[model samples]
Target: MSNLIHFKRDELSFQPYSGQPPERASICRLIGPDASSSMGAGLACFDGCSIEWTVLYDELIVVLEGHFRLRVGERVIEATPGDVIWVPERTPLAYEGDQARVFYALYSVDWQARNA
Candidate 1:
């Protein structure tokens, strides 16, 4: 038997992202530590909002819908559908978007545990 699993976008259950405004962002964790020991994958939806945080793990973000923006230092990177953004670990950045949906994969599913 194969370990492959398929997920439907419509069936995903999104939860409010911690520390984010309720109306601004939500996330659906598709793959985590239980599925992959070293990586995590998820879908995130964002409204017109900006969130600032420091990443503890390297991340790759693929824009699925609408527009997304990443602000690192004085530079701002923008993405649309079919665009991909790479964020290195320990980078301080601001995530901004308007009606955007993105798929994100990150190294280190245990980042929170390791950082804490």
Candidate 2:
């Protein structure tokens, strides 16, 4: 018996991000607390949008398509396909993109509950 999970991008069902306009962003969570207590992973898509956020867990984001940008205060980080960005916990940042897709993995699958 094997306990392995596999997901295809085309088969992912994305939901509108609650904090953003539905037309601007969507997210598909691939792994969470139910799967792993220490880590979480997901895919996000953005269409000419920007999202302000404060991370509760350390995260690594890999750009899959189009252009992606991260604004941490006065510093701006830009990424294209095959690029990776690391964000530490407690960082206040803005995610910006123009038709971009990214894969992200974060420490602490239950960050929301823990932070709350």
Candidate 3:
């Protein structure tokens, strides 16, 4: 790629996610490998936030607004603003919050694959 891509808040596009995510969810597309593949920013309801487990290939979650309880395998991670959580491949992870929380993440895989 051309030294990757640069995106300003205003230069980004805001779009809602599909799936059963909270209605409060907002995402900004920063980089997309193609029209069907992407990596972006997301904000969702923490309380109503789905505790749906995810098996990440290589992912990192950085809290920006609030705190949440994170479950990864036998370990529980208490994450708050400024806290960064890293989940490696094959690890089942889930997040819980009393209310909605905002977060930034670096997703290096194809979220469309829906790996179990």
Better of 2 and 3 by lDDT: 2
What's the distance in Å from true for residue 41, model 1?
0.4
Which whole-number lDDT from 0 to 100 does residue 74 have in model 3?
76
Question: What would the per-residue lDDT of candidate 2 be over residues 7-115, giving only the tens digit for each residue?
Answer: 9757999888757776689899999999987899999988888889999999999999999999999999989999999999999999888899999999988999998
What residue runs in model 2 are displaced by over 4 Å at the alpha carbon? Answer: none
The alpha-carbon root-mean-square deviation between model 1 and the true structure, to one decimal in Å, is: 1.3
The CA lDDT at 16 in model 2 is: 89
TM-score versus the correct structure, for each prediction: 0.93, 0.94, 0.60
lDDT on C-alpha atoms for all candidate structures: 0.91, 0.91, 0.58
lDDT of 2 at 13: 91
Q: Candidate 3: how large is its RMSD?
A: 4.3
lDDT tens digits, residue span 1-116, model 3: 44655466466555554354545344555444463244544444465454656645566667777567778677778877777777776677766665535555545547556553
Arrange candidates, best TM-score first: 2, 1, 3
Give RMSD to native, each candidate: 1.3, 1.3, 4.3
lDDT of 3 at 56: 53
